[model samples]
Target: MDVTQVLRMKGGDGDYSYFNNSLLPRKVISMTKPIIEDALTNLYCDMNFPKTLIMADLGCSSGPNTLFVASELVKSIDKIRLELGNYDEPPEIQMYLNDLPNNDFNTIFHLVPNFQEKLKKQTTPNSSSPRCYISGVPGSFYSRLFLRKSIHFVYSSYSLMWLSQVPEMISTNKGNIYMSRTSPPSVIKAYQEQFQRDFTTFLKCRADEIVRGGRMVLTILGRQSDDPCSKECCYVWDLLATSLNDMVVEGLIEEEKVDSFNIPQYTPSPKEVSTEVEKEGSFMIDCVEVSKVNWDASTDHNVILFEEEVQGYNMGKCMRAVAEPLVLSHFGESVIEEVFERYTNNIKISMSKEKTELVNVTVSMTRNR
Candidate 1:
C-alpha cells in the first residue's frame, strides 16, 4: 500500500474516544453537555426542530461514550418538546451514527437498545412520536453520506483531524522514512500539509450536507493562538515522543525512526478554523471556544489497570494513528510493549503536572441561514 494509506492505520488501533470515556468525570460531563446543547439549540432554533430532523455523529466510534453524545442530543430534544407541549405531534429526531469501517460495531450495536430506551423515558408523548430514530451509517466522513438537505445537525467528536493518507513524498521515500517522530522535520511537514487538505475537504463536505440553516458542532484538538512555536507544543505528542526515546535508549527501537516522528497537524487554532468557515461562506460562527480536553486517568488511585490501558500496550496504537504511514520502515514488533508503557507514562506525567488545564478544544458553528 502507499505510505499515506499506511498512515491511516494509525487511527484504527487506539481511538481517543475509547479512552476519553473513563477519563471524563461525571461532573465534567454534566457541564459539557449543556454547552453542546446550547450550540445545537441556537442552530436548530430552540428545538423548534423538524418532525424528522436528522442529527449525525460523523465519527461515532464503537465506545460507550458515543451514548454520552446521544444522551445530550436527547436531553435537548426532550426539553424542547416539553416546552413546545405538542403532545399530539412530537418532532422525529433521527440519530445517524457514523465511523470508519474498522470501528467495532458489535460494541456500537450493543449500545443502541439502551440508548433507545433512555430516550424513550425522557421523551414524553409531546416529544417526537417515533422517538429518536438511531441507526449506524458506516463510511468515511470525507464523502457525502446523507440524502440532499436531509440533515439538520451534524456533530463529529475528535474525528476530523485524520488525514486521508500520509503525504506522497513519504510514500515515495518509504524505505528511508524516519523512525523517530522527532527525527526529521520533512516528515512532520508532509503530515501537516495532509491535515490541512483533509480539514478543508471536511469543511466543504459538511457545508454541502447541512442545509443553509442547519448547524454542525465539531470537536477536535487545537493549540493556543499565541503558541508561536508549532513544533512539539502539543502535550500529547511531547509525552508520546519522550516515551519513544526511552524505548530507543533501552535498545528497543532505532533512534532515527523515533526522532523523525511528529504528531499529525490535527490541532488547529480557533482562528484558523473560523477563517476557513467564513472563507467557505457555508457557516457562520455561533461559538468558537478553546479549552483543553485532556483528563488524567489516575493509575495511582484507580489501579494498574488504568495505566496499562492508557499506554502500556496502546502507545503504538496512539502513535500509529498518525505515525504509521509517516514512518514506512519498522524496528521489530517485539519492542512495542516497552514503547507503549513509556508512551503512556509520559502522558501520565503531563496530566499530573496540570490537573485543570485547558487541553481539548471544540468549535461549534452554524451553516449560514
Candidate 2:
C-alpha cells in the first residue's frame, strides 16, 4: 500500500471516525505528558531561552488529540517563562501540526481558533500571552518538510511505526497483511531493511531541520522482545489474516488478492531504533521505554472487558478507524463491515485466553552537533 495516499485515520466526526475511536492515542498522549514537559524545559534551556520557539507534531491526525501535545508544550513553556520572570515578554510558539496530504486538515484548521483562545485563558493578562501560531503541514515525515535549523522540539505519538512503503521483492508472505510468527526470514529481513532506510532518512531530514541540542519525543507501537515476529507486535495482524483467509474460503475474496495485500507498516524494537539513531549520527538517544497498552485502553470499563461483545466491538472500531481507508482502497469497501465483524469475534476469543496488548516504545532523543 502507498502509505502517503491510503494511510490515514478515519476522518470526520462519524461513528467510525478516528476522532470518536482514538482513546488509545489520547491515553498515550496523557501518559507522555511528563516527558513532553521535561523535554520542553530542556529544549528551552538548550536554546538559551530564545524569544521564539519552533515546534512540530509529526503525524498529527484530525481529532481532539491532534493538538494535545502542542497544547501541553505551550503550557509547559509558558510556565517556565513565567517562573523566569519573562512572562511579560514570553516566547512566540510556532507550532506545526503535520500529517499526510489526505488527512483532515480542515478539521484542525477549524479548531485552531479555539485552541488559541484556550491557551490565552490559561495564562495571566499581563504575562505577554505566549502567542501560538498553529498551522497544518500536509506531507510525509520520511522526507524534509521544514527548512534547516528551523524546529526546536519535535513530538510524535503513534505515528513513526508506519513505514514509508512496503519492502520490495517479498513474495513469500502470502495471506498475511503484516509480519507474522510464520513469516520467513526473508520477509523479516525485508521489513528490517525498509525500516532502516526509512528511519535513517527520517533522522537525516530532522537533523537538517532541528537546531543543535534540539530534542525529540516519539511514541510508536513496537515489541519489547528482540524478536520482530513476537506476538506483541504481530498477533493482531495474524488474527486479521485469519479473518481474511476465512473470507477467501467462503469465496468473499480471491486467494491471490490476499496474497498480494501487504500492509506498509513495521514495529521496530528498541535496539533497532537505538542502532539507527547511533548509525544516523545526528541524534543521541536519551531514553527508550516500552509500555503495554491493552487493546481497549479507553476509560469505559465496559469497553475493556472481553467476556461480552462490547470489548470486541470497541476494539473493532479502534482497528477500523486506522485500517478502513487502506482496506477499502484494496477490498472495494464491500466486505469492510463483515471483515471487521469477523475480526472482532476473533479478538473476543483471543482476549478471553489472556490480556492481549500492544507494546509502545517511547524514545526520547537530542540532536548532536
Q: How well does model 1 score by local distance difference test?
A: 0.59
Worst 10 residues of 2 by lDDT: 299-308
Off by over 4 Å in 1: 1-22, 25-31, 46-49, 124-130, 167-192, 228-233, 259-265, 297-333, 351-358
lDDT by residue (tens digit), candidate 1, 230-334: 532354555556666666678766777754443334566677677767777777777777655334321223544555335323433444333433443444456
Runs with alpha carbons beyond 4 Å of true place in candidate 2: 83-86, 124-128, 299-308
> In every candidate, how many clashes are there?
27, 0
The model with the greatest TM-score is: 2
Please report, in order, the local distance difference test score of every candidate based on alpha carbons.
0.59, 0.85
Candidate 2: how many backbone clashes? 0
Model 2's alpha-carbon lDDT is 0.85
